[model samples]
Target: MKVVIVGAGIGGLTLALFLHKAKISCEVFEAAPAIRPLGAGLNLLPHATTAFSELELLDRLLERGVETSEVHFYTHHGQFVDGEPRGRFAGYDVPQISIHRADLHEVLLSAARERLGDEAVRLGRVCRSVEQDPERVRVNFADPSGAALPSEEGSVVIACDGIHSVVRKQFHPDDSAPIDHGTTCFRGVTRWKPFLDGATMAYVGTYDTGKLVVYPIRNSIDAEGKQLINWVIEVKKPNDGVRDWNRQVSIEACIEPFVDWRFEWLDIASMLRATDEVLQYPMVDRNPLPFWTRGRVTLLGDAAHPMLPRGSNGAAQAILDARLLAELLATKEPLIALKEYEATRLPATADIVLTNRNRSPDEILRIVEERTGGQPFEQISDVISRGELDEWQSRYKRVAGFERERLPQ
Candidate 1:
């Protein structure tokens, strides 16, 4: 069967790879004129890592990304809250990777070309609309210049288009607009001297007081050994700010909150100032839909379920969707397989969507911030018991479907 996969982002490329492995014929249509590595750092939790490892892309992922050693939490005053080992260190078969968004995209795209052939992905084709019949579905595309392009027919169509998915809008036009969480973020990558273990992902401060997530995405961008550090400073704001991925932000506008962040291992305030460029994006997501598949057409990745990036499950969930959908289509009838895919994933992802907004790994920091009055704690166990911390972390793991105990033996 010929399947048309929309959007060549992480989700679309992964779906193509999975389908290829299943011996299915498919094509990826990307809106972008060229597929280039873009975006900042994306963390692959152990669950998502397992999916990729099954596809045999783990070594290539590690080669292009940093295998994150631990995730650390800190107070606004720079005191350590908690540090936990990730991936295999946490006893999972796969290791978690903190990779540059573009690097991961390249790895997936390169594999698609080598395994599925160069013609597998067609660029500069913007999907306009889709119409499905009893036997086949027709997808319409337009050129970058807005000229009408010939339509293509397929046995099934999957929309992997991201946040602003046209296919999703076509299906759910009356749906509520993306829910804004009243937060604005300033993100960018800068060439800076490595800090800490260099492989650690750190989250500092509180959202009410401005929080920072920092990690090194690349080892050396220049001859001087300066690492490409990716940092994001999210502030609780009254407005959603903006939506453009390439939107430029002034460093001065968001640096006031980090002025006091002078941690011993790294200078958070200085790193923001040293950034080569800054990109601003609003933290927004939609309520999960009841279903992602309709007839011969379905949704995958961000299009299927857009969640806040708080837990680093944005790309991971998308990859999981692709893997699961590919698995279903491999064995069952196409139409029945799509429904089974939804049955297994829609509710699972819906839990993550609601949970991400309410309780995530970082929620622990929120609790500590509230209980400790946002001050330095002489003893963390007094402010928040280790038992409380463990419970908070465990709850999130179970909800995101990555509890260590749930892994296959």
Candidate 2:
């Protein structure tokens, strides 16, 4: 059976690789005339790493990405809140990778092109719609000029399109527009001297006012030992702006919130000012649809489950979805496989969506922020008990399908 996949971003390419490995015939349709590495850093948690390892691309990813040793939490004052060894350090078999979104995309895209052939990924093809009957599925696309282009037929079609997916619209046309998180995030990558362990994922401050999440995506350049640091500034607000991922943000608007964030280990204020470019994205997600599969077409990645970017599950869940869909298709009938895929994942991801909305790992900071009345205490232990913090972290892990005791083997 032949399959057609829409969108050539991370999810689409990953799906193509999985299909190729399973000996399933498929083609990828990407809207961009050319795929260039775009966007900021993305975390590939262990579960997702498991999928990449199956595709034989882990070594290449390790070469291009930073293997994060620990994920640490901090207050606006830079005081340590909590730190945990991630990936193998945390006892998971796979190591967590902090990679440039572009680097990860390129690695997957190159592998897909090499294995599936240049014709496998049809660029300059914008998928406008898909139609499926009992016997076959047809996909329609337009060129960059907005002129109608030829349509292709396949046994099935999967939409891996990013957040604003047209196919998802066809499935849930009556769904209210995606709800905004009431927080606008400004992100950028800058070449700067390393901070902390040089491979730390750090989240600081509170979003009630402003918060910063910073990490190193690349180790060094020019032999100066300067690392590529990716940082995001999220602020609570009635944000009004375009929702485009590539939207440029004025450094002044978001930087002001962190100006007073002076700390001993790193001058948070200075780092914010050093950024060369800043991109703004409003944290927005739609209510989870009751289903993602209908007839011969199914949805994966952001198309199926778009959630808040917090907790690093955006790409991880997409990777998991691709692998699970491939597994189901390999073992079951296509239509039944789609339903089984949804049965296993839809509720699972819905938990992630709501968990991200309420109690993510960062909730520890929220607890500290409120319990201490946003003031520093002589000892963090006095502010919040270790048990409480561990509980908060554990709960999120369970919902994200990574609880310490229950992680998949």
Candidate 3:
């Protein structure tokens, strides 16, 4: 069966690699005029990294990214809350990778070109909508100038077009707008000296005022003890604006909430001040659909389930979707395979969407913050028990399909 994959983001390109390996006839159509190295930082959990290992990309990924070791939690008062071992330090077979999104995209695109042939990926084709007959599906595309382009037909169309997916809108026309989640954020990468473990991912403060998530994406970017560190600062918003990753904002406007974040371990304010550029986005997610398939078309990744950036599950779940869908389509017919893919991923990711809203792992910090009245605690144990913390973390891991016990070998 001939398949058409839309959106050449992480999910689309990876799906092309998987389908090619399975010997399934498929092609990828991208909306961008060119494949530029775009986006900021990203996290690849063990489940996602496992997929890379299977594709023989583990070594190259390790070279381009920092292998994350643990997650350290703290409060605005600069008080330690708790921590958890991640990747190999946690005894998982694979290591979690913290990387620049552009680096990861380049790796996937390179692999796709090598395996699927350079002509397999067609850029500058913005998909408008999908039309289908009993025998095949046709995807219409428009050029950058708002002019119509020749449509392409295939056995099925899988939309990986991202949060603002036009293809998803064509199907779920009345679905509510993206939920703002009451947070506006700025993510920037700064070249600075390493903090804590150098490979640790740290989250500080609750959403009551501001939340800071920081980690090093590159090990060494300079000669005199410098690392390319990625950081995200989020504050409670009065109302949500347009959520665009490419939009940038001034640090001064966003720095007030974090100026006093001078902990013994690291100076949050100074690190943010050193960033070369800061990309802004509104934290948002859509209500999950009961179904993602209408005949031969379906959704994947941010296009299907745009969860909050609370957990590192976004790209991981997209990889899972692409893997499962390609496997099913390689064996089953188009209609049957698309339904199977939807049934497998829709509810699973839907659970992640809802869980991320209320009970994500980061909620532990909020709990500690609220329980301690946002004050510095003499002992973290005085606020929450180890049992409670473990339960809070493991539940989200399982819901997001990255539970250690259940990971595919």
Q: In angstroms, give how far residue 367 of model 2 lies from its true place.
A: 0.9
What are the lDDT scores of the predictions, listed in order?
0.87, 0.86, 0.88
Per-residue alpha-carbon lDDT of model 1 for 1-409, expressed as tens digits? 9889999999999999999999999999988998665678878898888888878999999987888888998888888889889888777888989888999999999999999999999999999999999999999999999998999899999999998888889999987877888777778888889888888999888788788899888886789888889888888874454666777868986888888777899988888888878888758889999778889999999999999888888888999899989999989999999999999999999999999887878777888889988878998888887888778878888888888789664
Tens-place lDDT digits, model 2, residues 216-279: 8887765889888889878887458477878886799888778888777677788888888888
Q: How many backbone clashes does candidate 1 have?
A: 0
Flag regions of model 3 displaced more than 4 Å. none
Model 3 lDDT tens row, 56-128: 8889889999999999988888777888889999989999999999999999999999888899999999999
Query: After best superposition, candidate 1 residue 273: deviation in angstroms?
Result: 1.0
TM agreement with the true structure for every prediction: 0.97, 0.97, 0.98
Q: In model 1, what are the clashing residue pairs, if there are any? A: none
Which window of 10 residues has the lowest lDDT sum in candidate 2?
400-409
Model 1 lDDT vs. the true structure?
0.87
Distance from true location, Cα of 140 in model 1, Å: 0.8
Residue 223 lDDT (model 1)? 91
Cα error, residue 216 of model 2, in Å, equals 0.4
